[model samples]
Each structure stands twice: as structure tokens, then as C-alpha cells.
Target: MDSIYHTLRKSNPASARILVRKVLEKNNGNVSKTARILGISRATVRRARDGELNDLSRRPKNIRKKMDCFLEKLIAEEAKSTGYRYRLLSYYLKNKYSIECHPPC
Candidate 1:
């Protein structure tokens, strides 16, 4: 029991959660009992039981470039020649080349 406490304390959060969940399973999923044994909250025990301890990515799935290669090169040339910043370049591209350039979504 003291060894278990020391092991959990020394391990990373994910590993600790895994250990707790294994113990919870061994105790037949008694939330309060597991929480009490681990000296953690019942909500923490429940969350660990439900496998919600792992980190989730916040990145978007459908990420893509707003502009293509040719348009990118054109913008570079225009920027080199006119020294225009993003907002000005966007306006210039829209009005002059009929390109719908805007900031990334």
C-alpha cells in the first residue's frame, strides 16, 4: 500500500491515472472506495474510469492552404515590388487580380 502510493506519486499523470484505473477495476469499480483508497476525489475516480485522463488535440481536421502556389508567388513578387503588408496586399490582389485573398480561418 505504501509502495503503491510512492509509485503513483513518482509516475507521470497519465501513468498514475492508468494505475488508479487498474486499482479501481481490481476493487470492482467502487467509485467512493477507489477515491478513498487513492486519496483523490470521486469525480477523479469516475473520470479515470471513463478514460478521460488522456490529453486531446485541439487541431482542426480539415486544414488547408487558403491560396495556391502560383498565387503565393504572385503575392511575393507584388510584395517585393510594392512593399505592401498583408492587409494592403490582400486589397490589391482582390481589386487588381480579382483574387479573393483573406486571413486564414
Candidate 2:
């Protein structure tokens, strides 16, 4: 049976890399043997050995926001002119513009 690393994914890169290093040491730095044990490719084991172990962000660079920029600007403008807090701004947006807004915490 393969090790848990074969099925497990999106693991913390730093921790994974550390584990890879320890396993490599135990196997006397054999990349092929280490890869088989970890259930990963030899290249992957090599990458971990080469020290590229930082966790990559799961969040995408271009995220779709619930409130678009235009609406956010409008809310900001209203808040600035009216000197109203987020609660009041939220209320005004709901009642006057018929738009639902949850003020950012």
C-alpha cells in the first residue's frame, strides 16, 4: 500500500518539505527511494530537497467581490458626506437605494 501522501494533497508546504528532508535522510538521500515512500514523483522529492517549501496561497489573485468597486465607492462617498457610520450607511443604502449592504467589519 502507498503512504498517506499519495492521497493527501494541499498540505502545508513547509511541513511537507521538512518531512521530505527527514525521510530523505533516513533513506540516505536516495531521491527515487524517497519518492516511492512519499508516493510522489522523484522530481517532487528533488524540489523539496532543493528547499522550495513555502506554502502557496489558495486564494486567487483576481477575486470576485460581493460588493463591486462602484458600489464600494458609492458607499464611501455617502459615508464621507453624511458622516454616517457603517450601520447608518447600510440602512441608507437599503432604504433609499433598495440595495442590501453589509458593512465591512
TM-score of each: 0.55, 0.45
Model 2 residue pairs with clashes: none
| Candidate closest to the true structure, highest TM-score | 1
Relative to the true structure, how large is the alpha-carbon lDDT of every model? 0.78, 0.81
> Can you list the residue pairs that collide in candidate 1?
none
Error of 2 at 50 (Å): 0.2
Q: Per-residue alpha-carbon lDDT of model 1 for 8-38, expressed as tens digits?
A: 6466657778878888998998888888888
Q: After superposition, how far is residue 58 of candidate 1 from its true place, in Å?
A: 6.3
TM-score of 1: 0.55
Clashes of each: 0, 0
Tens digit of per-residue lDDT, candidate 2, span 1-105: 645554343555577788888999999999999998888899888888985668567888886666688988988898899899988889988998898988778
Error of 2 at 87 (Å): 49
Candidate 2: worst 10 consecutive residues by lDDT?
2-11
Question: Residue 26 CA error for candidate 2 (Å)?
Answer: 0.4
